[model samples]
Target: MSTEAVTVPPVRTPTSRGSDFAELSRRIKAAGLLERQPRYYLLRATALGGVTAATVAAFVMLGNSWWQLVVAVVLAALSGQLALIAHDLAHRQIFRTRRPSQACGLVVGNLLLGMSYGWWMDKHTRHHANPNHEELDPDVAPDIIVWSQRQARSSRGIARRLAPLQGYLFLPLLTFEGLNLHASAVRAVARPGLKQRRIEAVLLVGHAAVYISALLLVLSPAKALAFAVVHKALWGGYLGAIFAPNHKGMPTLTGNDRPDFLRRQVLTSRNVTGGRVVDVALGGLNHQIEHHLFPSMATPALRQARPIVKDYCREVGVDYAEASLVSSYAQALRHLHHVGAPLRDAA
Candidate 1:
């Protein structure tokens, strides 16, 4: 296989970061190892099955006043994970068959994120292709991308620091100042595509109607609100950590700084969760190194790639960061602190 040299930016370290990233990308592409459709489908079925059962369980267990909050949190987490499953399925990164994945994505990912499969597929494909590029990537919303170039004309330092942390756990801050929400909005507005925009609009309206009707007409407002808030909080927290770890703390792009696209994903990502919890909790996404090596590869294979990728990272002198769940969460926070340091710009 011919190896491509990746050009690094000024802010980047003069190391093998880009090369390692490139190597993984090349391996994945050459191997033709994409997602394991059957395994992915099975995982989805199990997670969704659990979620559906849990929802019924939540209703049945709602009888426990003391455990209501606990049950709610669990239920919400299940749904969020289910949504992510749908996301994987939709991308058919899990299942190459578009029709099956699309059907599930339309149902689960949309319902879970309060979004639509049609709209998400379009923008998300663009994001994976060009992450953190101010021009091409509309994913800059949320707390990650603050201050337009207008806001950062001079003091890039203060501008970055001044960005909002939004919220920590057990707080509703994330729900109100949603990064994904802002991302989809800005992206929809900027892109001049009416069809995708309309799809997004329908999703939002459809979700809102469901939320309202469920909360008002079915469950007590207290119950509905409780469910919604807890569920969103769970999903939001996961998204926050994943996004921050992905590229926010690594590098920003001018959209033309790099030619090795797949390599950048490798350098910018880390794999965590080396245990069964990796499977039960993160769906093996913690094996980001493996995923980078094979974008289309299923999550189960991520564990298999962990050792190979780690050794490769070490051989090349690039950091192969892997931590337990506890450490990864802390590292994620530290990452936010590092990247979130204020940048002062008078724009």
Candidate 2:
């Protein structure tokens, strides 16, 4: 089959037009998949804290040695992990109440990662409400990269020029995603409407102050710069890789093309198939369909929920897209290339 044909998975139209989502929700609730996993989260948070402390200790002990670059890599990975935890916190996966979830989200996102929790929460909430939507989903909105042909056709200047090769450029561009995220957070807080803007700004400033100070204090200026570059680049790439596969290659819904809830989530999202290590690395995000369906489901329970979701999707005749880690990226890239075809021909 042609790569274009394989880019999007075949979605079976629902055989019965019954209340599919309600039935699936009933099954999932009966399975107790929506229950909070406080104990699991407690253990996860404690472990992450201990590792982060050890990484910091290693950085301090390593002193002015160039070997601290290794520490930078570790720190970058830890930052990604922290961001994943913040994602869960934003979804209220670990906490039952908004107050506790927001509190933890601020600490993990703004205070540690220099990202605005409020900004991310608002954006992610919209994404869950309408995944892969050409107009409504902020994720697919025309940005540095265009996801739809309509956006591609309207692109100007650098974005227009880059559209044709965007498939290949996507991963490379993510190297700067960390910096972009920090910049976005600052811009978000600067705006008037974001909730707790002042608090977010303060915490973001604190993160920057402490992060840069520690780097300069521990290493020479040149080494510190290199360390920062490597750390941020890898952190962005890691986080981007985790999220890119979820919906990029899937069918995008345009105006008035809305599917029912179950079909919408299952058909648009792609699941990554892997073992325990991938689960930990991606922080249960590999089960993208399950995660979207049950946003507040705990990380540990996502794996268990996956089969149930897949089975139900099959019974309802909706496609449940699944791919290996590598293939998922390929599928996404193909879609990018396909979307940019018009731009390429015009060039």
Candidate 3:
């Protein structure tokens, strides 16, 4: 799933930074990069809906055949795309107001994808506020896998045993991410304090009921189970790969290490270098530096904002990190392996 929100702090920068971000912001505003692209989102959503319908038709047509596995892969890709749309919705990139954004997000995330918009919004807000901060960013929090040497040292039980091999196992571990996201949504809705808990709960339950029922009705029990596993696994892997390059190997922040707005985002975020195909696959997340700097900017506009941000960063002497898709993954894996080095030494 995509990580995004518009809850970043106000434009506070250090004096040495010299209103650098303000200048960049002015250029972006003059360029009209912040405006919403209603037509783009409309056509995109329409195309996604049509593809989903066709996939469902194919599922019925194929009917209990082992070839349904192919259909399962298509559904996984579609789910990833739907999640990306929901990500834009959460950021108000499609709709400016909270009501419209939340309405669309719930329909796409909870109803269609069986993921929780409310839960994801909360987690993503903190992440945008602090992209790679060890303590603040939930995306980097130490859990099943650790992101830092300190975390690797503190890891216990399964996490400890897994830490040393985590770099090698990262992709394999991501196969379960789809299940983790669904389970997290369920737990979030079940607990107290989440906004619109009842509505989210109802939508989530409805999605699960319809999804499971459709699978069972269309195929045999064995085939249904296999289809579900493949769909979830591939969906998780696809989404995880999309997000991995954004900040995994980038420098992380910690206690009291606050940089200016531009430096904070530009320093910690890495941009993936690719053409239109990569942009489509990653949902414009390849330009993560731009996305983090302007959380509410529409996905399509990120490409336009990139050069402006990059040039301003150079003038201000902030490092702008960019890498090819393969190189980015390699850098992230290397960082993971390096972090686990202490654990290996201790062993």
Candidate 4:
């Protein structure tokens, strides 16, 4: 954990940003934490896959009983776990080569989680390249909800009415996020433009066919529908809850604001403080600042790199935001509520 003293960069000034990036990168690289451990990755993938399979089996065993609700909860939890694995595979975090990673992503994402790997990679890459950017970051793009004053002001009709209450609605809306992701992926793969669209579309179809068939085989149609809704909604909300705190409350870059790479990432990403269970559940996204700094870094390594990165930023007078999970969500909600005030004014 020893390192040379690094020079501090001035806040909001980009002149010395290159030095900051170089210094931080140097420290992180020096630790040799960047090296991939195949065993770790394989172990995680195997365990999560087992959980997914076991949960699916349990659901089938439950049949049309009142106890299927318990199986649905377990399935939802496993779905979230698989989604995290899919995200890691998407980032090429586990496998050194692209092919294996892509294969794994297809198995976990498209087949198990019912998400399109190609579609997610496209959107996720843009998000990583320009996180929290008002225009470029797909994560923050104006839609049914608004995250900033400009977006709130431009709202119309139903969106306009909902804009003011968006903070309150955020968690509730996440219940539909799983369905939205499925629909969006379907549309993206249907379009002629994406790479390997046909393959991804087939995988998605396979997911739907297998999933629906399994549920309907044992349960009545109405019960199956209920189980599906619960599983998907809970999965979506779990994903959203983990990801939202990473950047929702952070300073967002607009067209005019162009900070250098290190500064922009550090300023925009927030970390959460917790132990291994939280790390596993969040897919090591609890170390979001470190992950954003080094997108390809393995999740296990992110925790080791955290103190080094945090110390460097502290020495350089850069802000490194980290809070408890509860605190971080509250901050995000507060930011959303504050941003929505403009919508109220517009009304």
Which 10-residue span in candidate 2 carries the lowest summed lDDT?
Answer: 1-10
Q: For residues 189-285, what per-residue lDDT tens digits would candidate 2 score against the true structure?
A: 9889999988999999999999999998989999999999999999999999999999998888778767667767877889999999999999999
Measured against the true structure, the TM-scores of the candidates, in listed sequence, are 0.72, 0.95, 0.95, 0.94
Q: How high a TM-score does candidate 4 get?
A: 0.94
lDDT of each: 0.55, 0.88, 0.89, 0.84
Identify the superior model by lDDT, candidate 1 or candidate 4.
4
Ranking by lDDT: 3, 2, 4, 1
lDDT tens readout by residue for model 1, 1-347: 10111245323243553554556556655555553658656766876787678776665656524355576667656655765576577556766677777766756644545655566667677777765555566565433334233223333353344443421321333444334553564455446664445555566567667756745554666776776666666667655544444443344456465645444556555666657765656666777656655656776666766766677656655555566666666654454333333332221
Segments in model 4 whose C-alpha atoms lie over 4 Å from true places: 1-18
Full-model lDDT, candidate 2: 0.88
269, model 1: CA deviation in Å? 1.5
* Prediction 1 global C-alpha lDDT: 0.55
The TM-score, computed over Cα atoms with residue i paired to residue i, of candidate 2 is 0.95
Model 2 ranges with Cα > 4 A deviation = 1-18
